[model samples]
Target chain A: MTGAAARTRALALALAVLTLLPFASHSQFFVNLAMLTAISAALGQAWNIAGGFGGLTSFGHAAFFGLGAYADAILQTRYGLNPWLGLPAAAAFGGGAGWLIGTATFRAGLRGSYFALVTLAFAQAFGVLANSLDITGGGSGILVALHPGAGRFQFTDRRAGYALAVALLALATLAAWRLSVGRFGAHLLAVRENEDAARALGVPAVRVKSAALALSGALTALGGVLYVQSYLYIDPGIAFSAERSVEMLLVAMIGGAGTVLGPLLGALVVHAIADTTRSLITTPGVAPMLYGVVLLLIIGLLPGGVVRIAAVRGDG
Target chain B: MAEAAPLLEVRGLARRFGGLRAVRGLDLDVQAGTIVALIGPNGAGKTTSFAMIAGFVRPDAGSVRFAGRDITGWVPERIAHAGIVRTFQITQPFAGLSVAENIRIGAFLRTRAPAAAMEQARALGSELGLAALLDRPAAALTVAGRKRLELARALAAGPRLLLLDEVMAGLTPTEVNDTVALVRGVRDRGVTILLTEHVMQAVMALADRIHVLAEGALIATGPPRQIAADPRVVEAYLGAGAAARLADG
Candidate 1:
């Protein structure tokens, strides 16, 4: 108990300090960079819940992400609601969408690549809808007014936006941590390992998987809300980009899926590589190509992701 | 004398897979706290019957009644929730997780706390002679160890009715003997067990009653001694007088 308490306290302290570090960086460039990394970490951790732990490989997480961004944007710009309200709205809508997708696919017994394709289709379909919807401002997109108030969830200090991002990542990290040590997590991992075996032992496989997706979707949606609040503008292409979906999975996979700190570590490395490549190469295609090459090397060399490296080091 | 109703009762349970009549018109009953077995040659529909009872396979015809309530075609998890737990013929352990974690998931059925589940899992592991392997990965275990782990995992669920599929399918005679005693111990703990096995020695030693099947239907049902002597059974499964040979062995 004492060890557990100490570890938890240390973790909380670490997260708290991380949220405050952006303030110390006077350079706007560094602050924005930190914000992006934190955003990626949160999104990655969100995907990890379902993808890593539950063995639910979703290829279209952009669906929930875009839905959340659009939910906030529309609610704030069109419905004339407080941006803070968008936080809960995003979670609700994201969770609901996640539940819907999980129920539909799992009930139909879709798994592996089929489930992945279905989620991808959902995101692609949502992109089409967002592009054409009247309330979404269609292809033109919507802009959130620059309201600098805590109630509006946008702080006048640019670093405060970074703080919000850090806080979101912390919440996601905390959720993953909770799952690793909890009963629900045990059932989930059992289902992932062997669904029929788990069912024989009385695990409600479908329910557990569905609930995990909902939780993951809710958190992922919250990440979308953070993005909109930080930038104050969103269009269909930016909100529903397939590349963003790839980034979320890459962060978790490269950092080590099913691990608590995988996404955080993945976010750091992924963004560092992105930033370095963008600065070093002006050719747009070259930057993406370089990113792909580096990722391929990491994945090929460390198949279990960077977190497994920590495991090896700890044991050896 | 009016006998109490059976803990489990199957009436005319049937299923057909495409061109094959896998199970047809099968009936079964087991009283509380008894060690019964469903025995037959391969494709005798013993496994299929067990699957229907445990809710893994839906029956094409007839009903499954437990404690006087109909539970036909319920999902496997829901049937397990009703105190009926089944273990696979092919051992299924979460390979990456530790032996304790494998049992802990079963314990999770009754408790929501990890500490409690882990504690119970450890206790069950030790009871099943797996204390030393608690922290080891499940995939590291031998066939005998996996069989024990399967039992420990099911026992952790505190099941009233345990359906074991070929639990002793592949094991040394010594290991089979150990499992026979282990199963008898489980029955003494107030669990009703229904097993499907080709292990005749185990069947003779453990089963209070035995049901014999052939070609998707029951051809004989009696006590272990009588089952060994049934002419229909001997013709269908056992040789002309294997009972005397079995008794000698």
Candidate 2:
């Protein structure tokens, strides 16, 4: 099949799978698995906007993730605001933070490994600040009241959360697809490849990168909001963890950093492995160890990620 | 009939790199619908001047105006948007992208719609004799293929003024001839070109006016024939041998 046809088929398959997800045999287990997969896919898609398309390998994306979770938690628990209202708010916060980080560093001509370090530092600092803050519930975290209703976003059934997560993931995927085909997408690719050349060709490097990073952050924050909503609690350690950030990157990187479907495939593969390993070995720490080893093997084999491998195959 | 105004005007443009004056008060003009060649000895700051014009380098002194607008110290993207696009000495094709996709990125500027961009890219590829190679990966292209890719990419941008830096540097004679033809075709489409080249034959054939630089200064500016005859230009570019040949002609 042609590449476009293959992409279309893959997309159709993903949609079909997501549609049938709520009806699967293992209702509770599959719901949890699908929710995790959706969240991971959404986060990975978000990261791909900057890290994949813009070639800004961010190691600090969890800052936005944590921000979204905390923003939702703080608003719901302390102020009695609905989690729904916090969705857009979290997106805005994430986008704003991304803009600030992207501009300050990109304007100073930091990229590649250096840019990654700055992102890492930002996440670390945010984590530290979150831990030190009294109003933010410190490291102990904030609790969200679980009222099984549409208004509260707390559902008695896991299917509802799974469905919502799927919706968010779908939206993220659609946005990624749209951006990857538009003028902004072209500029992002140009900046990713050669900033000087892109600039010479009229691609505003700073603005494009900043916008991409902001979009990435916003999408990531949206996922975070969903995560906290589903869980009904948030803590600095869970929300602002570097390991969480690495997980996000792994999903995007292992699939293909730049392509729209990379993160989704990565999430599917990762979640499959995690599920299989958890089911087979009922042992502690083995699952995480296996996950790490699998990630390393994938990275070693496909340095550019599975999406790139697919692209190569498609080209051939 | 030539009242469209110069596309670029540089006055006393200068730049220094940590106590070294790389470009010193250079003045130049590139008129609309003309091909101007900048020829200079190595380290005479030819590429630096191109970089400044393309806004890669900030001028320490003087003004740069694009199409009668003061664009001094403007950002590179803004300058490019203002219709001044540049090519590198070495092509920087996105290795991961197909040749068609690379050109499609350039064509994105002409129209925001993806369909329109693809159409523009297809048209450009056909014009550049790259229709057959469009689907190929840019990194897989040969050297001459890269030069073509570079031109196709720059042309795809729909630039009003194209800055070509050593595009013909490493081409075979046949490829050089083809490139010269390609450039003329591009010029015929009404895009002004400012090319920096070491190839005297291509410069003589394509450039409407020649500007010879020596030590970051414009030593001579005139038609190719007049430029070839200028003592300073001949001395700077060629030695007494070329000067004698020009004098005899």
Candidate 3:
């Protein structure tokens, strides 16, 4: 294998081995934290597919997250449907929303900051709709009853949830890695660099961007479903908040935007900082304040992300 | 000479940007396996005409046909897939990607497999004297290198009709000579070329037929020697000193 490929495999194997720690730990608190980290990494990876690789920087991915959470939570609470069936339903809903949003905005030739604002607008609109909708439980949100079984997609133990989160992260990383090395990935980057040039070379730019958005939306929705299941509840404020969208972008950017494993690394570092600051500061927003500083520092010092530094060093 | 049907046909291709008529009533044809030159003064609508033909610019009124098929108003990607590809006047390599990767993007137009694309990129790099620099990032290349990389990328798409816009614009004389030979070599390999050039020497050396445009209108079309002797062509380029300049030459 090539050196870079070998290094990637080794790193993946090491991370897989580390996922076993939550299972071995007796403390549920630590296991839960680990699960949260894994979920964040998965979400960040989803954002990376669209924002990083496809070069469509969205500032409103919470729309998909909220949609997935609401789709699953509402179905289980209102109609008494199985969570298993709701998962696919939520994914489809998210993908459909992605297709709709992508097609409309891209077809209209909205790019750069305009595209970002449109996405943000969509998320805010969805959040407002969720707040007033009766079926969604309105501003109070929906609560899913505990089925407490593997068949019901609910786990009795935190370790099992951690395992599922880790599995999701692994699958997301694998997908990103496969895409990074393939023709589709090349097309995505080409379109990102110069859309007109890529089009001249026979890449269907709009179609590629739409596909990326759909895949990213579905994966992010899956993360939302996991989040809802873990918490047993979801509100529009929690699921569709602008802060949630920024958090995903921060995680991806902090680790490495376009690299496959950057999101995981970013999630780990961001969570660690948040955890460390929470212990020292009692202020409600102290952790996020510190995160902003760290993001600024990272952008100023290592704009390519921490992963690129390692790549450069490895190459040297 | 008996002639096969033209590989590309443009009829009444025109475009206007607000009050500026960039191109008006431009008609062009490219015969199979021939190198056609579109020459004009700056702002004579040469680039706009090329853009309209390549499907990048939406012509205000025009029809573009390729290989006997009507392809007017098609998108750039669809036009490329129909065997036409174009390079920009300013080289636009993916700055973050390695040279091989930049070319590989074009190679992917013909192949679905990444390995095959990479192989094609490598082969094209070697053919274009860029084999040693394939691993280098495109951002680091010199202007001449970027221009060659741009050509290599367009060639990687396996185009039957290649539209080159100012491919020799900023090159030194030696580089222009080399590029002139390279462009002729491309035409010799069965690809029809439509090019716009400012270099009269290169145009004379390479073009099978020349078309002159002034103020977005075609003024003359003929063999290089015939064009050099034509009064309208000379007057269009040299203003009123055509006969004197012709005598001086």
Per-prediction TM-score, please? 0.94, 0.94, 0.97
Per-residue lDDT tens digits of candidate 3, residues A9-31? 67667667777778899899999
- Interface RMSD for all numbered candidates: 0.7, 1.2, 0.5
Error of 1 at B6 (Å): 0.5
Report the candidate with higher lDDT, 1 versus 3: 1
Shift of residue A47 alpha carbon in model 1, Å? 0.6
Docking class of 1: high
Every candidate's fraction of true contacts kept comes to 0.95, 0.75, 0.87
Per model, state how many residue pairs clash.
Answer: 0, 1, 0
Model 1 vs. true fold: TM = 0.94
Backbone clash pairs for candidate 3 read none
Residue range B75-152, candidate 1, lDDT tens digits = 999998899999889999998789999999899888878999999999999989999999889999999999999999
User: B1-249 in candidate 3: lDDT tens per residue?
Assistant: 327778999999999999998888988889998999999888889999889888998999989999999999999999999999999998888998999999999899999899989999999998999989999899999999999999999999999999999999899999999999899889989999999999999999999899999988999998899987888877877787876777798
Residues A1-316 of candidate 1: C-alpha lDDT, one tens digit per residue? 3554455456456656766788888988889888888899999999999998888988899899999999999998888898899999999999999998998899999998999999999999999998998989889898899888898888767688788888889898889999999988888899989999999999998999999999999999999998899888888898888898888999999998987877877887898898899999997699989988999999999987877665544332
Candidate 2 Cα outliers beyond 4 Å, as residue runs? A1-4, A7-11, A24-26, A282-287, A307-314, B1-5, B238-249
- On DockQ, the stronger of 2 and 3 is 3
User: Where is model 1 more than 4 Å wrong at Cα?
Assistant: A1-20, A282-284, B238-249
Superposed on all Cα atoms, the candidates' RMSDs to the truth, in angstroms, are: 3.0, 2.5, 1.7
> Considering lDDT, where higher is better, how would the candidates rank from best to worst?
1, 3, 2
Ranking according to DockQ, highest score first: 3, 1, 2
Give the alpha carbon lDDT tens digit for every residue of B167-247 in model 2.
999999988998999899889999999999998899999999888888778888899999876788777766657777777
